[model samples]
Target: MTVDSRIIYGSWNLEEPTTPTRSRLFCLEPIGLGTAYVESLTGYVARLSETHYVETGMLILTQIGPLMKEGYTFDGRAGGIDKLYGRYTRAFNGASNWTSALISALEHLTLRHDLKFLSVLPWVEVIPLRYLLRPSRAWCPVCYQEWKDAGKQIYEPLLWFFDAIKICSNHHYPLCTKCPYCQKENRPLDWYSRPGYCSKCKEWLGTNQNSIQTDLGEPLKSDLNWQLWASENIGSLLATAPSLVCSPSKATISMAIAAYVEGTSEGNVSSFANKVGIEDQQIHRHIKGKTFPSLKTLLQLCKHLEVTLLKFLTEEPTVEDLARASARLPQLKNSTKRESFVIRHNQSSIELALKEALLENPPPSVTELSKRLGYASSGPLYYHASSLSYALAEKHLDYERVRRFEKMRSILESTLQKEECPPPSMQDVARQEGFSVQLLTTTFPELSRAISDRHKEYRQMLKTVRIEKLRQEVKEVAFQLNKQGIEPTRTNVSNCLSKPKSIVMQAAIEALQEVRHQLGWEG
Candidate 1:
């Protein structure tokens, strides 16, 4: 039976409404204390559906509304019904922003008093979709076991869904993606999917906590420590999302990156990409608002780039604000990794190096400058003098780009004027120049035009040479046929020659006509 399209209200309502109508069907408290923060949308919906003995499918129709009515669906892949929150916000509360819509959804659906604790919704607007959430759910077996042991309702924390977090900060264990019993992966929005239990086979997901210790190497341990730090910081940032006066903007992130990699080899986007193992093109896209990073990728970049997550997310965090947060990170006493921590106490040597580097004839790059001054990475230059370092790097990168363009133009122009051999085509020139054709055209338009003109003449000269070569081959074949007492007709000569008829061209036709006139065989 088809349902009517009008928005349904009063299908169910509370009798003698309590000030904060906490659901009685299931007294599930938010995972972190008595706060209103629920860990994930999957957990929240699963608990709500369980109270009514319904599955995810029924919850969508009854709770999330119909496809045509509100354009809501049970399966939105990784984003999962987050879109529904927006629709519900517009429909009932008439709220415009995602943060308000989220608060409205919690109040309307479950009436949970802990609406203020839910951090994900508040942060939904600020974080780019790439770093916001993951498609498949991740669970820490230790966390599940702890929740079960405490007699608490089993649920997934919103923290696990962030792509940035791989290891559990509490246990230092990696997250699990599959059910222990059935060994199958489950999507968070599956029709019958339940939190803390396998969607298939209905097995508990907490039993597969392996006792094996994760010890990859020194580098991996350092990475694990960094991951643990990031988990806590990012998690705390989300937890406080509801109370933030103004959300962190993309400009804030750009500010942090520009501040840290100054006066170093890793100052420019290309070098930064190499240092961080991300594509330079992607870095360009992210800065330009063309795309965004995933949460995991963003955190990894933060760790390597030496910018604290707190500062990056904070709107106009002071130098002291960054120092306080950075000081908490574990320092490597002996390791050679470049530290980007803010150095406010004494910066005389740093200042001297910057001055010398800036004054050099061919300005010493951040990386080269760092090497000469006995530094491992370029992070410190930005840490101490962020604005100046960034300005210098930007100026140097632009200067270097122009210098390279001029050098390439000179090389190409000189190559074209060479009298020893014919000028190479653009493709050949690009191969010798070690640049892409697109780069050649886009970065060096004037040179591209010069190459085009030279290329046209070069092609014509090659064509003439090929025709003369074909003409010589045909004449030799015709002479050979005549010496053997075989009539050198056009068809006979064509057969006599090994070259294809197409390549024989007008030269072959002229040769055949002359041979015919000499032999008086013009029929």
Candidate 2:
């Protein structure tokens, strides 16, 4: 595909489809002033060495170098370049400066031949080499070979603009420009510095509100509609890009994963690396070797993968999938569950160490137990203790909570063997069985302080509920007395209260219910 240099010159200044128009093309527009013009497709930019300052210089050479011989006209120049020197040479007043410009021109032209001008901002996107080709001139950055239809040429400025956005110093919203804590650290480039925190001793103290947002200057967001659009378009941008490699795989998988998990395409190996606190190279090496990461590395992987490290490094995932999982894992419960698991694993491990120690002449102390077991601190043992506490409470194991539950079971069995029916009241049952209500409440049934508090609340509600039931029972008993030709009124109930014995209350309640049933007043 030979691009006629003359065609470029003719279209250069025709009427740019965009502003900040290709200045290099503007410089050559007049060289084809007398030729028959071909009005380019609306957004076509002239053969572009890319929009870089250096590439523009190459376009100046290709567009002007040949035209200069016949005496090219001087005109369309933007932002100071070569004079229309005798053609281009005559315009230069001094030999040294002209030679310097000549050298810059040659150097630029050489570089443009292989230049892969990336069109992107902080995160870059490489412009396709095809979009950048021009057979007669340098290449045109605007001509995309993968056009939807031959006749309807649409140039996605946003595509090019985002590249510019990534590299530009001005867009301040996706990331803040001023770190309220440290004014020095908020550019897009600063993102790699640290998960930035405020230097100012504010309440957040070492915290950052780092949510990526769109640039405020943007009138609309591409993200809202880009999902479906990307379903069609990302394939073009993603086709086997080297930067996208996750081992031998193209970046599409990483990008697809990030979209699924993070609801965006911000996933790439480097982004994963940053979260894991390992250089991308290390992760590449680990996965490339078909190896699993160490435990610490596993946790880091989980931070971004949104899975536990065990699942991440294991051959087959063991999922404990549930909604509100994020809520379930506050530091307290997570640490607690972790402590229990660690304690159980360690306790089994510790028993082995103890057996070995007992084989020696002198057994090791509890402190030495950890050293022999290769544990870093006594904290692991303490973590185990906490684990036991929960197990004892839930009665899940025959440990603490289980011991109390069983003890309570034993007492109830013994009392039942001795008496036909103990009174149902809490104090009466305790008194008859030689049990202390306080000890029973606190120990054998061992409700933790939290459970005790919860019970207190339940007791408050039960106070009203229990009192009403008791009153109904008393009424039935009194009615039974009346049916049997004895006084059974609220006033007569004082005698039962005065009698002071749970057995008396029991007899009264049973008789009342029996009488109430006969009277068609079910209790």
lDDT of 1: 0.59
Residue-by-residue lDDT tens digits, candidate 1, 123-211? 54346654355566788887787778788787767777766677888777778888777788766555566778777777777743465
411, model 2: CA deviation in Å? 3.7
- Top of the candidates by lDDT: 1
After superposition, the stretches of candidate 2 with alpha carbons farther than 4 Å from their true spots are 1-305, 308-405, 414-523
State how far residue 271 of model 1 sits from its true place (Å). Answer: 5.6
> What does the lDDT come to for candidate 2?
0.33
- Please give the range of 10 consecutive residues that has the lowest summed lDDT in model 1: 87-96
Task: List per-prediction Cα lDDT, in the order shown.
Answer: 0.59, 0.33
